[model samples]
Target chain A: MRYAYYPGCSAHSTARDMHESADAVARLLGIDLVEMKGWSCCGATSAHQTDRVMAASLPAANLLLAKEMGLDTVVTCAACYSRMKTANHEITSSADMRAAVADAVGQPYDGSVKVRHFVEILLEDFGIDKLRKRFKKSLNGLKVASYYGCLLVRPGNVTHFDDPENPTSLDRLVTAMGGESIDWPHKVECCGGGLNLTRTDVAVKLSSSIVEMAAASGADCIAVACPMCQASLDLRQKDIDAATGKKHHMPVLYITQLLGLCLGIPEKELGLSRLMVSPAGVLKALQPASSHQV
Target chain B: MTIKIKKQSGKSLRQTVEEMSGVDMSLCYQCKKCASGCPVTKYTQSPPSEIIRRLHLGAGDELLESDLVWMCLSCETCYGRCPMDINIPAVIDALRSLALEKGSKSPRGDMPLFNRKFLEAVKAYGRSYDLSMIMGYKLGSGSLMQDVEKFPSMLAKGKMAVLPPSGAEKKVVKRIFDRSKQAKGKKK
Candidate 1:
C-alpha cells in the first residue's frame, strides 16, 4: 500500500494532470505514495546520450534512496521509468558498471530497488477487480485510444512490464472503467519525445500519425501514460493538424486522468483544462444527451 | 547517397563500438530487422541496419559524422526486435558520445544544444528547471518564438513555475557530474 513515488520533471510541468490525478486516485484507493525526498532528475534521454556513467549514476542515486526506504519505487513518467529500469538492468548485470555508478554517486547500490511504472502499479498492485468495484462513475460511450508511446514497453528484457509489440494493460484499465479501448497499430509508436524541443517538425510529423490513427479508430480521446506522449499528442496537435490539413480535434488525456474521471473526481482538480485540445466533448458524454436542453 | 566503403585498419569501428557499447555488432547478420522496426529510419539517410552494416564493413568516421545517429529516436524497437539481441540504442549512444567528444559538429541540427542545456540544468538544480532550461535553450539555440503562445496559459494553469527548483541533493548531483567529467577526461 506504500510506494516511493518518483514523479519525474513532467509531473511538475506539462503533465501536471497525470501527477495530480495519480495522487488523487491513489489516495482514494487507499494507497500511500511517499514522494522520494531529495530525488533528482532521472537523466532521461540527455544523460544516456551524453555520458553513460552519469546516466546510470543519476537513477542509481534515486534507487539507493528507494532501497534505503525499503519500498518499491513507482514512476509515472514512462521516460523516467525506462531510464530507471535501464539503469537498474545495467548496474545489476555488470559488476564493473555497478562499481563505476557507486563511485560516481558516492554510495554502493545493489540495484535491489524495484522500479514500477504507474500503469504496472495500477494493474498489478491494484487488481482490476478491486479497481472495478471502486469506480463511482462509468466511462460508458467513451471510446479511448490507449497510447503506450515507446518507453513503457520497449526493450522487453530490461523493462519486463508488458509485451513490447502489443500491450493491453491500458486497454484492460479502460475496460475496467466501463470505457472502450480502441485497438490501434500506432499504440507503441514513437511520439518523437524529446525531439519536440530538438526537432519540432519530426515531432509534429510523428504525432500527427498517432492522432490521425486514433481518430480513424473512432476514439473520442487518446489516453497516454507518458507526459512526452501526452504533450506531443495534445500540445503539438494543432501543428500536426495544420501540417496534415486534417481537422482531427482529438483530446489527449493521461491514463491517471481517465481513471480519476471514472472515480468521479472533479475535472478542475485533475488539471483537465491544462490539456491543449479540450476534453469537454468527451467528458460531456457522461451525461444523458436528452437531459441537456441545448 | 553512395557510402564509399573504405576498409580501414587499426582498431576497427566494430571493435571500438563493441568496446565502448558492450554490444557486439558482429552478431548482426544483415537481418535488417532493426532497420525495419526503427521509426526514425525514414527520417535518416542511413537506417540502423545500414549503420550496423557499414560498421560491419569496417566503416568509421562516416558513421560517426552521419546524421542517422543523431536522428535515432532511441525508442529501443531495434533493440527489442534484434534476434541476435544486439542493443542498437546503446551502440548509437556510444556513437553519439564519441561524436560529441571528438568535437565533431552535429549534423542533425540543435539536438546537442538542447541536450547540453537540459543536462546543465540538471547539474545545477539536481533536476530539470523548465523555465531556466527554456531560457537557456532559447539563448543557445535561438528558438525563442517556438511554443511562445502557450507560456501565459501554462503559467496561469500552474503548469510551469517562473522560479527554478533547487532539489535537496544538489551537491550530490554536482559531485556525480564532476566524477563523470573526471572519468571521461581520464579516458581521453
Candidate 2:
C-alpha cells in the first residue's frame, strides 16, 4: 500500500524520531510513504484557537496537494491528523467553506483525498495479526500504558477510525507487539499541548498527574502517538517532578518506536535516546535474557 | 438534615454537558473514578464527580457560577478513567466559555487575571513568548517579587526566549483573528 505522507512540523524538528520509526515501519510493512513536498505547518492547538479558518485551510492545502498526488494522505502526528481530518470534514461538508478555503489556498479542494493516522494505517491497512507475525523480539514483560491524547480520538465525526471515548487501537497495537497494556487514568488527557508555554504551572500539574497515574498502574513506560504528547510528557517530565515534588518518571515512547523495537529495529536508529527519560531500562526489562540474568 | 429538593427545569444536564463538550456525559455512571483521579478537585469546592452529577441533574445555571469550572486544568483525568468516556475537561471548557459569555467573573481571583494576561501575551505576539507571558502574569498577578530569582535562570538556560516566534503565516493569522472576532460579533 502507498500513502502520501504528511509529517507535520514536529516530525521535521523535535519529533524526528516519529518520522524515522514511521519510515522504518512502512518499509517493514512494504507500504510506500511518499511525503507531500513543501507541506506547511498544520496549525495545531495554536492555530485552531487563534484562527479556525487558517487552521482548517493550512491542512486543507496539504490535502489538496495529496489529491494532486492521487493517493490518500497518512499523517504521523496526532495533531496534524486531527487538524487535517477536521479540515477535510469541514471542506467536504460545507460547500461555501470549501469554496472559500479553496480560494484562499489557490487550489481546488475536491475533497477526494482521505486523511489517515499512522495508527489506522497500521491496524486497518497492515493488520495487527500480520504485524504480530513479524515481531522477532516480543515485549513480553513490559507493561505499557497506551496514552491517546485528545486530538486522535475527539470530535469523533472527523476521526471516525476508533471509539473516541474508549479507544483501543493503540492498546491493540501494543498487545500485538507482545507488551502488556495497563489501564490508567489520563490515557486520553490533553498533555497540555502548546498550553505548556502559556500556562507552565497548569501544564506541569496536568502532565504530572498522567505520569503519576501511569506509575501507580504499574506501567514501566507510557506509549503515545502524538509528538506533542511525547514532548509534553517526556521533555517536561523533569519540570513536572520539580513542581509536584514527585520522583516518578515513566519513560514515554512513540507507538511506532515500540513496534519498531518489537520488530527488532535498533534503538539508536529509532531515535530512542532523544527522549529525556531513557527507555533502555524498559527495553532491557522487555528482553527475556534480562529477566534470568538479573 | 434533609437536602432541599429544588425543582429541576426539566432539561437533562447530561445532554447540555454533552452538547458543550462533544463528550457523552451520560457515560459517567457515578463511579467517582474521576473524583479519585482528579488533582484539582482537592483544591476546589466541588469534586469532578459531583460536578458531573450536578450537571447530570440539570444544574446548568448553577454550574455557570461554580468555582469548579475555572479550577479545571483540562487535564482530562475524568475522560480517561471514565468507563463511559465522559470528557470532563471539555465540559469544563464549555462551562468556562459560557461563564465568559455570561460575564461571570472567576471567583478565584487570580484566574481571571491570569486569563487576561495570557490573552494579552498572545495578542501582542502572534505566538506566546514565555518571557512576555511570565512577565505579564507576574505584573498582572502582583507576584513579580516572588518569582524574581527564577527569571534570571530561565533566561540563562534559554528556556525563555526574548522574542515571540512570529506566527507561521502572520497575515493569515491576523485574518483568522479578525474573522473569528467578526464571527463572534455576528453570533452576539
Candidate 3:
C-alpha cells in the first residue's frame, strides 16, 4: 500500500529512533511510504495557541502536498496527525473554515485528504495477521506498556481515533506481536508533552508519573507511537530521579522498534543505541537473546 | 484563582471567547468532569472547568491575570470527557490569545514567551530548530542555564539537530503567519 508520510520536526530530531525504525519496518512490510517533500512543520501547539485558523493553515500546507501526491497521508508524529485530522475535520465539516484555510494556504486547500497515524495504517491497512506471519522472532516474554499520550486519542469527536480514555490499538499491536501489553492505568495519561521544553518542571512530574505507573504494572518497556511521548518518557528519567528521588530507567521504544526487533531486522536499522534508556533489560527478555543481540 | 467578578458586562468576555473559540461556555452546567480529568490542575491555581466558568462570568482582567490559560497542555482530556461536549482547550486557546494580546502578567511566567519564540523559529526555518529557539527563549527570559546540562547528552545521543530544517517553502510559511495575524486583527 502506498501512503504519503509526513515526519514532523521531532520525528527526525528528538525521536529519530522512531523515524528510523518506522522506515525500516515500512521497508520490511513493503509499504510504499512516499515522503512528503517540501512539507513544513505542523506548527505544533504554537499555532493553535495563538489562532485556530493558523493551526489549520500550517498543516494545510502539508495536507495539500499529500493531496497533490494523490495518496492518503500518514504521519508518525501524533501531533501532526492530530493537527491534520483536526484541520480536515474542521474544513470538511465547515464551509467557512475551508475558505479561511484556503485563504491562509495561498491557494485552494483540499482539506478532505485522509490522514492516519502510521500505527493506524499498520493495524488497519496492514492487518496484524499479515504482520504476524512476517515475524521471524517473537516479543515472547516482553511486557510492554503501550503509552498513547495525548494528541493521538483525545477530543474523540474530532480525531475519531481510538477510545480517548483507554485506547487499545497500541496494546493490541503489542499483543499481536506475541508481547504482553500490560493493562496499565496510565495508558492514555497526559505526559504534558507540549510543555516539555517550556515547562520542564511540569514535564518532569508528568513523565515521572507515567514511568512510575508502568513500572508498577510490571511493564518491562514502554512502546509509544508519538515522538513527544517517547522524548519526554525516555529523555526525562534523570530529571525525574532528581526531582522525585527515585531511581528509574524504563526502556521507552517506538512501537515500530519492537516490531523491527521481532521481524529480525538489524538492530542498527532501528536506531536502538540512539535511545536514552537502555533497552538491555527488555532485549534480554527475548528468548535466544544471543540471536537477537540488539 | 477564582476570578472576583467586578462587573456584569459579563457578556463581552463570554461573547468574544465564544466567537474566537467557537465554543459555547453556556453549554457547561458545571459538571466538573473537565476538572476531574485535567492532569495539570495540581500545578495550577484553577482547573479546566474553572476556565469555562470564568469565561461565562466574563472574568476578563482577573482571568487573564491568572496563569490558567498558559498552563493548558491542550491534552484534550477535558474536551473528550465533558458530558456537555464543551471544548475547554479551545476556550483555553482563546484565553491565551486574549492574555497575550492584552500583555497581561503571567503568574507562572515564561510560557507565552516560549510559545512566541517557538513560533518565531517555525516562521524562520519552516520547522523548529531546538538550539535556536532555546537561545531565543534564554535571551528573552534570561534563564540561560536552564536545560543546558542536558544539551551535551542530547547531542551525544543524536537527539538534538544542530541545524534548522531545510527544503521548506519559507515564503509560504511566512505568508501563513502573516495572514493569520491579519485574520485575528480584522476580527478584532
**Using lDDT as the measure, which candidate wins?**
1
**Which residue pairs show collisions in model 3?**
none
- Which parts of model 3 have CA positions greater than 4 angstroms off? A288-294, B8-11
- How many clashes (backbone N, Cα, C below 3 Å) per candidate? 0, 0, 0
Tell the DockQ for candidate 2. Answer: 0.10
Q: For residues B118-139, could you state the per-residue lDDT of candidate 3 as single tens digits?
A: 8998999899887788888888
Q: On residues A44-76, what C-alpha lDDT tens digit does candidate 1 reach at each position?
A: 898999989899999999988888888999999
TM-score-based ranking, best first?
Answer: 1, 3, 2
What TM-score fits each model?
0.96, 0.68, 0.96
Q: What TM-score does structure 2 among the candidates reach?
A: 0.68
Off by over 4 Å in 2: A110-112, A288-294, B1-188
Please give, for residues A147-206, the per-residue lDDT of candidate 2 as tens digits: 997778865655786876678999998777667888876777666664454456666777
Q: Which of 1 and 2 is the better model by lDDT? A: 1
- Model 2 C-alpha lDDT per residue in residues B99-137, reported as the tens digit of each score: 665677655435555555544544454344446655776
True contacts kept of each: 0.72, 0.03, 0.76
Per-candidate Cα RMSD to the true structure, in Å, reads: 2.9, 6.8, 2.5
